[model samples]
Target chain A: MGLAKRIIPCLDVDDGRVVKGVKFVNIRDAGNPIEIAQRYDEQGADELTFLDITASSDKRETMIHVVEEVAGKVFIPLTVGGGIRKVADIRKMLNAGADKVAINTAAVANPEFVKEAAEKFGSQCIVVAIDAKRVNAPSKALRWEIFTHGGRKETGIDAVQWAAKMVNYGAGELLVTSMDRDGTKSGFDNELNRSISDLVTVPVIASGGVGNLEHLVDGIKEGHCDAVLAASIFHFGEFTVGQAKKHMAARGIEMRID
Target chain B: MNTIAVIDYGMGNLHSVAKAIEHAPGNCKVIVTHAKNEILAADRVVLPGVGAMRDCIGEIKRLELDYIIQEVSKSKPFLGVCVGMQALMEYSAENNGVDCLNILPGHVELFDANMTNAQNERLKIPHMGWNKVTQNSSHPLWQGIPQDSRFYFVHSYYVRTNDNNHEAASTDYGVKFTSAVAHENIFAVQFHPEKSQHLGLKLYDNFIHWDGNR
Candidate 1:
């Protein structure tokens, strides 16, 4: 068998609790991060991503604690994203038992941070999260631009060029999130995913806008992503990770199915 | 209680490795250290490396862990992981070709940039994700582990031994590459057993009870 396509269930963690919102709005509490993480692991999630959406710095310690507890019990690869601004932040997360750290706004603010973090910690642990919004309509030439501050501020950077630049700056993986389709329960922007995936040599994780098992399949088959990350679909118990894997495997996608 | 010294040269997921060992079924004191004395005193030793081969080897030499690792590998139940596995080879094509510990007879090479699968699709580098590893030969470490089990892997470079007898397991990632290697008391793998979930913990448990024999 070859390298199986990964199915990652993302948990939007806020103050140590798991939360999910529609297009980054109307937040709702899911459950405890540790319990949710264990449940996902039991369901055969290939990997788990924890996006720390906690706004207050004082509450950030909760995220670290959550990572530590889950990491102690969960055996799969764990990735921590959000609020990672400095190398110290990356260190704390890694030391807290996170296998990888994803950087978004910080990388946009200072591209050098990616290089420095990758150098300090191996590139294998550094992931560049890109939040992209479509600049052109469905009929026009495909174009997407990077947005920061939870997709409110525009960086005026092309998503495709930014992805390649991050890889050059030593990003081991790219987490591409579609702003337009995120939480809409529609699907992933396959064009945007393919655009960034084809340009970079590192693995690209397609995130945001996963509504069904078919979307997971499209992320790999059409979007060309190495892995698919969904927050609501798996978090809300709409579909189990095992079901997603079986569906993807049946659709001719090589998945890690026991 | 046995002590498994996870040799720390300032690289790799030392926390995860130590934690996994502690969580394994076997009762052992897992310490993440670079002190030669502690490593020598331990019943088992683990060499874990991440990042570029040059950096991994550089830190091993800078910290003077090379001799310690060599000494422990001779008699102790030694396990190397990822770049740790590559570092056991004589040479590596990574970081402009660097010398390794040469504990095992092999050369580490990068997966071709243009490497494609049977479907003619180009595979990503690093080969990041869960891939099934086919056990090539029977060994103590393979005790509870199934014949073909999936393990978590995240690396661009792979090991190729000069002697086929050193290969313990293989995985197909476009090209069939050696995923695990065993030479006497030493066993090394390109995949991360600590991050590989239940099956991975089983491997660590097996390593703990291994007697460093055939």
Candidate 2:
């Protein structure tokens, strides 16, 4: 395949503290976003995505400064999301040194905004972020629905189908996260990931449910995702990019390992 | 003192390119600036980028680096990485239309969509991660680099050589494309040396000690 399984470590910042527990619970402070990102880069992370979990206009200042600092320290690509509601916000993030902008609530509130941002900045600059949880049965009617507003609100759109449409609206990449599996450390939702990946032409990043290196491998092999994004596993010293890549290489997956 | 002026016109990965160079080999001062004089005085100038060829080449025109670079391209060692390398060509990769550096006698076009896994379900686009490199002929830049060694690559558009003489190295995917090329005083690699590790370090070391005059 043209795609290599990506090992991405996401940073969720709340009032400048990196917190992680179980399923987004027991939320203990992890570390500073900047320090965590720097260490991940050293540990050989393919790319980094930062989400300001407590994103608000007030929190924008802290997020921007953190982005600027991390962008300076890390050389690889960086994607910043959350609190990006206005066109000006996207511009500010780009100017502040973010390579790509991932949007969730704002995009669902106004899908037109994704087109506008993509048109202005180029498709490669916009990432349509989807946080979806499986319905009780995930029947034909409930398959792959979109979850937004920090995974509290549900927009009756099918996550897989929505991903397929987001590309037409001009999103460069797709960040599909599973709310149920997030921080579970149990594993990733390969079936859900595969269903959506099959429906989209754009690169689909598998998020949530990464407990160890094997989960990452399953995310790539079973999910058919271009990249596997995790936060708790990489943040809490579960597995490093190097160690994961070693496992991936053992499985005949090509990775940049020194 | 060898100072490498990293051209900054809001059109490329200027900082990372400079960072990689700084982290590479030999003592050199790396500064990202639009200052033409800094470029004029520096021992070497790097025109590096990771954006569209259109945006990058446009900034070069706006900042008037085209003139300074033209002069430096003739005498000193000039290196292009990715879009920087594509710019060395006659014209390639204009998202809106055709606007290019026209340095080398070649063109860069989008990867044949057939090559993308989305299309053929075969080779990937934005060819991410490490892949192997195979050298066709000997060049100093390839010195110390091993055979069948892998390097990091992340791009869809590649420089298609119209003149074979400019071709230096090649990498394989489903099909082989130009990975490294050199013509006269210019040298560039599609695979990122900065991202590439010890082997990449050897690449930087070779470039630093290289005397392209031969």
Candidate 3:
């Protein structure tokens, strides 16, 4: 069988609780991180990503505790992100039972940190998360620009170029989230996903704007993303992971049926 | 007490591998260790590696786990997972060609970019997620695991054995490639059983009960 496309459920955790919002605003508590993670795992999620949206230094220990609890119960790959600054941060999360750690602001603050972390703790465990917004510039050819601080500020780095550079810096995977479509649930930005996915040899996980199973399919079929990550759809029970898998399989996409 | 020592060369997620073994339906003590004595003394040994082959080989040599692995593989039931499986091969094309343990007669190669499926769609690198693995030959590890069962894989490079006889199972990623191999006391897989859910745990259960004779 060919490689299967993955459906990942993301938990936008804040202050030790899973939260969901509209465009990263108007936050509302969803449930306990551990309970939500266990539910997703039982629902046949291919992978789980927990992003501590708050990223406050004081809440770091709580995040680690959440990771340990979720990992102890869920027997799948768990990716922990948000406020991951240094190699020690990555080490702490991994030791807390996280399979991989995703970094955004820290990597932009110091690109060498990405290279160092990859060298210290294998590129396979290092994921570079990029939050991009479509720039409506008439002069420049670059369509999307990278954003940091939970997609609040723009970094002026071209999204496609930054993705390739991260691969060169030893990023095993790229989690590209479209800020413009995140929380809106219109659909994945297929054009942006295709551009980034085509430039890098590594796997690109298309994140954000997954309104339904069709959006998830587009992420793979058109966007060329290896996997699709969604927060609201799976979080709010708008769609089940099984439904997504069944739809993809019906469309001739190879998925684990058993 | 049946003990399984998971070799830790300061690479990959050894804790997850240890926990998966502990959770597997058996009363076994799973230890993540780098000590040679503990590994040699354990009833079973698991070598789990991740990331680049160059760093993996370097750590294996520096920590002298290479010798320990060779010794342990000869006597006890030895299991290799992911890059641990890749390390058993003679060499890998990763990092511009890095030599491996040479425990098995094979070499690791990168996924060809131009490779496509019957639909002419190019497959992504680091073949991630669940895909069915065709059982090439029946072995003890396949005791409960069904034929053509799905397993979780995450890697850019895959094993290409010189001898097809060692292939226990295969998977199609653009082209058919070896996914699992067995040679006497040694059993290795390019996929991660720990991340694979129930069927993966079944593989671990079978491994724990295996006698290493086949």
TM-score of chain A for the candidates in order shown: 0.98, 0.94, 0.97
Q: Write the per-residue lDDT of candidate 3 for residues A161-210, one digit (tens) a residue.
A: 99999999989899999999998889999999999998787889999888
**How do the residues A72-127 of candidate 1 rate in per-residue lDDT, one tens digit apiece?**
99999999999999988998999899999999999999999999999888899999
In model 2, what is the error at residue B66, expressed in angstroms? 3.1
Q: Lowest-scoring 10 consecutive residues by lDDT in candidate 1 chain A?
A: A230-239
Interface RMSD of each: 0.9, 4.2, 1.4
Best by lDDT: 1
Q: Give the alpha carbon lDDT tens digit for every residue of B1-214 in model 2.
A: 7777777777534555666676776886888888988888877777777756676777788888888878888877777777788888887765845657777788887766455433345453456556777777787788888876777676768878899888888876556788888877788888777656567767766766666653
Q: Flag clash pairs in model 1.
A: none
Candidate 3 structure lDDT? 0.89
Query: What's the true lDDT of residue A118 in model 2?
Result: 72
Among the numbered candidates, top TM-score falls to 1
Report the C-alpha lDDT of model 3 over B38-135, residue by residue, as the tens digit. Answer: 99889999999887899899999999988888888888899999999999999999999998998999999998877777777666666777888898
The positional error of residue A154 in candidate 3, measured at the CA in angstroms, is 1.4
Per-model TM-score versus the true fold: 0.98, 0.87, 0.96
Model 2: per-residue lDDT, tens digit, A1-258? 223456788898887888776755588888989889888888878788998887456766888888878766676678899888989998788767677899889989999999988766667668889998887473454466888887889888878778877888988788888888887877888888888776665678899888778888898788888888988877778777778889987987656665
Models sorted by TM-score, best on top: 1, 3, 2
Positional deviation of residue B162's Cα in model 2 after best superposition, in angstroms:
1.5
